[model samples]
Target chain A: MLKLRQGQAAIALVCVVLGFMLAVQFRTAQDIRSSIPFQRIEDLSQRLSQTEKERDVLLKQVYELRQTTGAESATKESENIKMGAGVVAVRGTGLSITIDDSKRLSKPGENPNLYLIHDEDMLKVINELWAAGAEAISINGQRLIATSEVRCAGPTLSVNNTRYSPPYEILVIGEPQTLENSLKMRGGVIETLQFWGIQVSLKKQDIVDVPAYKGAFRFEYAKPIKDGGK
Target chain B: MALPLVGLIIGISLGVFFPLTIPVEYAKFMSVALLASLDSVFGGLRAGAEEKFDNTVFITGFFTNALMAAGLVYIGEGLGIDLYYVALLAFGLRIFQNLAIIRRYFLRK
Candidate 1:
């Protein structure tokens, strides 16, 4: 009887762990249906086209607004600056750079972080691109702005407060050849990342469209100083 | 036996109502661990039916088997080979065999 009673403790403990594992698996599969699970690939492509159409309509409205508000001479210049700052989605012939975690298995003594891409890697690459005259940049649908912060969130990267994982796609709108060359220059960001076994690829494209910033901009302390009709 | 069954019921209910997420990397380890635990439980059941169940053996096997199986999977992942499938196949077969024995024991009565 004593032996039987003792065995029961083990039974209970094992069952609890088993139940927990099963539950976690169920939750993971449900959580990672990879977003828009209900929508097929065809539906997603169709949705993309719909969003593009909407953007066109908004652009026309902006153009009409500028024409009617002809009193403000600074409007056109501010609009151009807004587009360069990633407030508006901009399309141009530029470059696409993709950085992903190395698939190679780490050596027994190697630090796993060496093979993984970090937030600093992103900041470095973006900084280099900007220096090369990238008009606008977006990483994994998270548009880069003056306030955008590239940070490490556990095993993932967070850009502008949105979390993303490896294989980060960076779309830049500028001179494609110049941007690509700057990134791949000897002793540059590409070589530095490659030294850590990080997979980096720069591809020049005929057209690269960058998404607009999706985050709200809050400025409490830095109030705009108006020239007041200079 | 009653206490253990009650504990199991409580566990499953808690798990169902309050499921938690683990890291994606640990999924394989969790699977193999669960399989190993199931194997131990069934073995214990078989031993009890045959009047040879040992508490020490059951409890030690319960913890060690799960951990060892999970460790093998972790190692295999590092080595670029999946060891969980092997553990799964082996544990799955043993679980069914032990279950069959327990079923037959009840049928004999």
Candidate 2:
């Protein structure tokens, strides 16, 4: 009887180990799925389109009202400036930074793929630029929003709808000096990228027009729950 | 002596089975529900086991630990953190509780 009980105990221990392992695997799978970026960008794009339409209609109404009332021209001009600042498309003062793989790091004996920039490298740059207070950013013409997913799609990184090869060029529109200084700030993005043998360049122009964000932001599959229960 | 052990086996089996179909978010909630149900069922088993069955104190101790599991799940969901951490907590606590029960049973004999 003691031998039988001991055998049962051993089987029970095996079950516990297997059960714990299965739970770990399931949790990891769920975490990776949640980290994917595409869904967030899609949601942000929808919001941008909605805000733009609302602003346009309101501006037209303000103009019509001013014309009939013959109010001070200063008031109209001020309104225009404020509205322009709010939804005004910016044109001028932009800097572009390009990242490419380092050729020096590659050799005949070692991996020839040494020059490729991984996803995390790009993410770091993007995060730094945002911290520098960049008003708008684009990667190869794909506009980035708050929810944009910057991830590796195979060999290329896809931002919004566009994908590009090595030597990714990221463009930002904001105050020229501030944007340039932001990139060059200590720790600093430029110094860090150079260490990795990635190319970093900053060019500031007077007429840099950051385009209004164009994307669809809607979540069809996700629903918020009050209390998490089965 | 055997009934409570069978109850535990049955409980753990249900834990493994119920989480298969649900999303990770709901699987977390179900984990808490399963532990709570196990506690209640074990309570009934302890009443019957009386003399031969042991480790009643350790089994009941699992209830206090269940709250910690439930708390971790709530914090994870509230913060939009991945559900894996919550699963980690639940599995860890269950294993600890099991060990405590086993230790009590063996030491008493």
Per-candidate interface DockQ score: 0.31, 0.03
Please, what's the RMSD in Å of model 2? 18.6
Q: Pick the candidate with the highest lDDT.
A: 1
Model 2, residue B34: displacement in angstroms?
A: 72
Question: Chain A TM-score of each model, in the order shown?
Answer: 0.65, 0.53
Clashing pairs in 1: none
CAPRI-style class, candidate 2: incorrect
Error of 2 at A130 (Å): 1.1
Q: What TM-score does candidate 2 reach? A: 0.38
lDDT of 1: 0.79
**Tens digits of lDDT, candidate 1, A1-230:** 21332366767777777776667776766654552454356346645875897799889978877777665747866887888677888889998888999877786766888888998889889987886668898999888998888999998999898899989999998778767766764446786787666898888899888989987888889876687645
Using TM-score, give the best candidate's number. Answer: 1
- lDDT tens digits by residue: candidate 2, B1-109: 4533563456456545655444343555556644543443333333322333334443444445455656767666545565546656556665566546555554565
